[model samples]
Target: MSPRWKWKGAEAKALAEPISKTVSILQSSLTRTEASGLLSNHNVLLSVEAEQAELLDRSCFGRPVVACAEKEDKRWIQLTFEEAFFLFYNLNCIKISLHGRRLENEVELWRFVRSIKPNFATSYKAYSHLRLKNWIVRPGLQYGVDFVVYRHHPSLVHSEFAVLVKSVDGNDRLRVWSDSHCSVRLTGSVAKTLLVLYINGEEVNREDMNLPLCLEDYTVEEVTVRRWSPELNREHDLSL
Candidate 1:
C-alpha cells in the first residue's frame, strides 16, 4: 500500500494571489530590452503570438491566468504564467517548453505553489500554529525560525516562543542532529523562547525526561507542550 498524502487547503489558497500579481506585473513590464534579456538568458528566440499580441499591447492586472504564444520559424507556441516565471527565474527568458513546443504565459499561482515544497512546509506550519490558537505566528525570513508564536492573552504573563520544525526520516539518528541544530539556533537572547522538537513517530524511550523537554515522536502529528525551564523542571512522581 502507498503512504497517505496530506493536503493543506489554506496554504494552497495563499500562494495563488501572489503568483497572479507577479504574472500581471511581468507582462506589463516586459520591454524590448527586457524581452531581449529574457531571450538571451533562456537561449531562445522570441516572437509574440497574434492572439496574445493585443493583450500585451493593453495593460491588465490580477488576471490570475493568461497565456502567451511564441513564434519560431513557421511554428507558434503557447505558454502559461507558471512557465513564464520558471523561465524568467531559471533561464532568464519568457519562452518555455510545454506540451512539446515552446509556449508562453498561463501562470497560475497555485501551480507555482505546488511545485515548490518549502513554501508548503511554511504554510503548513503557519496553519498549524493558527489552529493551536497562536494568533501572532507569522512567517519569518531570518535565523532559520519558521514560525513565531506569541502569547494570546497578554495578561497571563508568559514569554513568547518560537517553534522550529524538522521533518526527519529516522528517530534516533535524526533526534541527535535535530537537538544540536535546534540548540544552536535557539541559543543566546532567544534562549528564553521554548524549544520544541517535533518528530515523526518511530522511537520510544522508557523514562519520562525533564528539561528542554523532549516529547515523544509521532507520525503525521501536532502537539503543543510547554518547555521545561530550570526553575519549573520537576520529576514525574509515580506515587498516585
Candidate 2:
C-alpha cells in the first residue's frame, strides 16, 4: 500500500487519517478498483489551513519566487488544480476547503472543482492516468503543453514527455497543423517526446457527474508525434 503521507507534518498527519462517511457512500463508476485500492483503501477529499498552506511555499507545493533567503513569499499555491486533486483524489492526503469550509466528500468537491475548471474530468483523467502508471507529472506551462512527465523525480532525471490534453468536447483544446508541428518541434528541441491524450473521443460525458470518477466513464488514448527528419532517417551513411 502507498504511504499515507509524503511528509508527515503534524497538521498534515492530523488531516490525513479519518475516512469521511461520504467517501464510502460515493458510487463512482470505479473502473480500476484494484489500482485505487493499492493507493488508498478509503476515498479522500482535500483541505489545508492558511497557516499550513503557507508551509507549502517551498519546493514540494510551490516554488520560491526569488530564490533568495530574505524575500517575502508573494506566490500562490504551486500545485495546479490537477495536482491538488491528485493529492486529494489519488493520494487522499488532504481535504479541500473553499472559504474556509471543508468540502466534505468527493462528490461535493468534484462539483466545486468542475465549476472552476470546465475541463476537470478530462484533464484529471490524463493526470491520474500518468500518475497511476508511476510517472511524475508536473505542469507544462513552460513547454506550452498540458503536462510534463518524468520517469523519476525531477532532481534525478529530466522530464521525458510533454503532454497535451485533447478532449472530445474540445473544452481544453486540439492543435491544428501549425500548432501541432510547433509542439513537436519544441519538445524535440529539448529531447522530450510530445504525447497528446485524446479524452472521451468516442464516449460522451456521463450525464450524472457522480458516475464519472471511476474512470469507466472517461476514455483516454495517447498518441505520440515526432517530426521526421530525412537527414536523420538514414542508417549509417545511406542516403535517403
Candidate 3:
C-alpha cells in the first residue's frame, strides 16, 4: 500500500506519468507492474509520434524510468529515491501514494526522502545540475559513487561517467588517495570516466526550503581522474 498513481483509461495524463503507472515502493526501489498498462501504452505513444518527433530525438522523450531484470520475461521500473525525486521535481511526473494517501506537493516528497537520507539536499542539487545538462543520470551505488551519467539513454549507449558528489564547505574532509585511485580505476575498467562534483554552498536547515532555487547560488566543480602508467602511455610507431 505504498503510494501509487490511479489512472482510469488508456492514455496517461502526462508524458512522465506513464512511468509512474502501477508503481509500488518496496524497501527503497520503485517497482512497476509489467502487464498491459502504462508501459505498453507508452510504447504506442512512441510509435505514433515517431514520425512527428523526427525533428527532435524521439528516443529521449519516451520515459526516464529504468527497468531492472527481475525474472524471465519480466522487468521492474526500479529507481532510487533520488531518481524518483528528480523526476518529480524536474519533470513533474509520477503521483506518489503514501499510507494510501497522495502527498500534496514536492515539499512533501522532499521531506519524505530527507527522513530516509539526511544528505538528500546536497545530492539533489548536484543531480538537478547534471540532469539539466541532458545527461542520463542514475544511482551509482555499485560503483561507489553518487551517480552514473550517460551521454544518451542507457538503452542506447553505456554510461560514460561515474559522479561522486562532495560538499565544498571547508568542513568537508578530503577523499583518501587509495579510495580515489580505486574509484578511478574501477570506472575506467567499465569504460566510464570518474567525475567528482563539489557542491559549494552553506548547509540548509529547513527541508521545506526550495533546494533547486538555492542551486543557482551554489557553484559546482567537475573533476575527472585518470591513471597514468608508462606502459599505457607508450606511443606506437606509424608505418610510412
Candidate 4:
C-alpha cells in the first residue's frame, strides 16, 4: 500500500478526538468504553480502532503498550500524542478533533501539540524529516537517542540507525563527552549506527508558524559515530 491515504469525514470522526485523539474499534465491533480501555496504558492516543490496530502488534512509534484488552476483536491502535501530532502537523495525513470539534488548520494543531509537550516543535522537526525520508522511525529513549530508524519494518529486522536530534540554537548545550561515549557503547551493543543529526534553522515563531512547515528550509548534518577498537582498526593502521 502507498504510505499515504486520505481520510473521509466519517473516518476522521471515528479516529480523531478533541482533548486528545480517540480511535473507535471499526474492524471489529466494540463499544467506545472497550476501546478506551485498550488505550489506558499507553499515554499516546486516547483510543484506537480495533480493526486497523498497529501499535499492539509492533512498537511503531517507540511507545509500547503495557496492558491492553485481550480479545482480538476488542484490540485497537492508538497513536501516542507524539504520533498523532506528527501525523496531523508533519504528514498532513490526519485531522484532529478538539472537544467535539475538528481543528481548522495547522496552526491550531501546532498549538495543541506544543501545549502538551513544550519541546514538541524541535522534536517534530527532526521527526518529520526522518519520517518523510520513509525510514521506520521510532522512539530512541532506550538507545540514548531521539529515534531508532529501521531500513525495514521493526518486525522484520533490527533497527539500523539510532539518531540523536540536535538544534542549531546556541541555547542548547553541546553533548558532553560522557554522553557521546555512552551512546556509542549502547548503540554498538545493539549493532546499530549512531547518527547525530544537527538541524539548522531559526527558532520557531509560534505566532507566525506556517502550515505545512517547509522542512527543506532547514538543513541537517548527520554525523555517524563508531567506536575505534585497536583490534578492529589493525588493518587500517597496517595500511597507513
Candidate 5:
C-alpha cells in the first residue's frame, strides 16, 4: 500500500499519498518550503527499502534522493509546513518531530509553526480552502503569487490560476497599483489567471487566537485580476 492521505474528489493514483509512519523533520533539515513559500512532494524521508527506490521515482508520492550514496543514507519525502500540518490536522496520517522532539497535538504544532511562519493563518486558510475544492495548490513564487492551483496533480495538467492572499481589513498596505500591474501581466504571460484572495473577519488576539481552531471564523473572497487591453477589444465599424 501507498501513503494514506486523501480528500474529497481525490484520485487514488496521483494524489499526495500520506504514509502511516513517523516523519522526523529536523530543524536543520533543508526543505523547499523555507526558500520558497511553495511546496513540493520531495521532502518527507521514509523508511523504504533499496529496491523500492525505483518505484518511488515514478510516483508523485515520493522521490528518492542520493546525496553521496553512503551506506547509511536514508530515503525521505519532503513536505512543506502547510503540507505537513495538513496531514497532521486533517488526515492524522504522519507524526512530526522538530529537532528530535515530537509535536504532541495540533495546538503544540500550531504554536511551533507560528513561531516560524508569520503569515501561517492566512496562507493556511487559502491552502486548505483550495485543497477542499480538490485543487492541487503548489508553490507559485516563480509566478510572483502565493500559490499556483492545479485542477489535478501538477504533473498531469497546468495550473489554471495563481493565488495571492491578501486582507480586506485596512488599506492593505502590502498591495499597490504597481504590484497589481506587474502581477496581472506576469500571470497572464504564463497563461494563469491571477486571483487576489481577500480574507475578512473579526480580528483575533494573537496571544489567544493561535491557540484555537479559528480558521472557520474567517471569510475568503476571490477576485480575478485580469488585464484590460483596449487594443485587443476594439469594436470594428462593421456597418461602414
Candidate 6:
C-alpha cells in the first residue's frame, strides 16, 4: 500500500505568523484617518475605519479578506499605503531577464514593474542599443533605466541614456489594423544616414548610418517572449 501524505499545518501556520506580525506592526504605526487615506489611495473602498482594521486582522491569517468581505456584502478595504508600498517593494525583488521574459507571470510582474518603472519600454530600447555596443547590460529598475551596463574602462563616461524601445512587429501591424487594415507608406528619398557608435568608452559618429560602416557593429540577438505559466503563478505570492 502507498504511504499516506500528511498535511503540514504547523509549517503553514509558522509561515503565516510573520506576515501577520508585519501587518500588525503596520496597523499600529498609523491612525484611523491615515489608514483610511492609505486605503483610499490604493483604490480600496472601505466605509469605515473599523472595517479596514478588521480586514487587516484577517489578512494575517492568510485569508482572502477582500474577497470574503465582498461576498458578505461588505465593501473591501483597499490596500493600505504602507501595504501597497511594501507589496511593490517585495515584487521588484523578482528578477527580469532580457527580452522582457520573467520566470514568473509577466502580467503580474509588469504590474509591479510598471508601478515602479513606468517608462519600461523606453528603457528597454536604450538597453538594446547599449547591448549592441558590446556592453553587458541588464534591467535597472532602481536607476530607472531599461538596463545597467558595466564600464570596462575609466575613460568612458558613466552616464545614463534615454532609450525608446517599441515592438517592431506588433506596433506596426496594430497601427495598420486600426487604420482599416490599410498599408502604411514611407516618404522621401534617403539623403544621409548617421551612425552612432560606442567603443572602448568613447562615442564615435559616422556619416553613413549602416551597420557595416559602423566602427564596431555587433549583431543583436532577439530574446524570445515568455508565455504565462500556471505553475509560476502558483509559486508566487500574488495575494490579489
- Give the residue spans of candidate 4 off by over 4 A: 1-49, 54-75, 170-174, 203-206, 209-216, 237-240
Q: Which segments of candidate 6 are over 4 A away from where they belong?
A: 1-103, 136-240
- Candidate 4 local lDDT, 14-62, one digit each (tens): 2342112112122122232233311122334434444435533332542
Tell me the tens digit of each residue's lDDT in model 5 across 1-240. Answer: 122223534555443543221122221122212211112222334443343333333322334455635355344455566766665576455566655566667887777776777677787888878766656678888887788876655544567898989865434423678878888888888788888788776787877657637787888998898987878667967464
Residue-wise lDDT of candidate 3 within 126-206, one digit each (tens)?
887886776657778898878887655454456788888888443242357878778878988877888888888766546
Alpha-carbon deviation at 3 in model 5, angstroms: 28
Full ranking by lDDT: 5, 2, 4, 3, 1, 6
Clashing pairs in 3: 3-97
Order of all candidates by TM-score, from best down to worst?
A: 5, 4, 2, 3, 1, 6
List lDDT for all candidates, in order: 0.36, 0.59, 0.54, 0.57, 0.61, 0.32
Clashing pairs in 2: 29-214, 45-95, 46-94, 46-95, 46-96, 47-95, 47-96
Number of the top TM-score candidate: 5
lDDT (10s digit) by residue, model 1, range 125-233: 3333342342334333354555544332212222255555654532331257666555454533454353344545334342311111222133344443343456544
Of candidate 3, the 10-residue stretch with the lowest lDDT total is 33-42
Please report how far candidate 1 places residue 49 from its true position, in Å: 36
Query: Tell me, what's the RMSD of every candidate?
Result: 16.9, 11.6, 13.1, 10.5, 9.7, 24.1
Model number with the top lDDT: 5
Provide the lowest-lDDT 10-residue window in model 6: 183-192
lDDT computed for candidate 1: 0.36
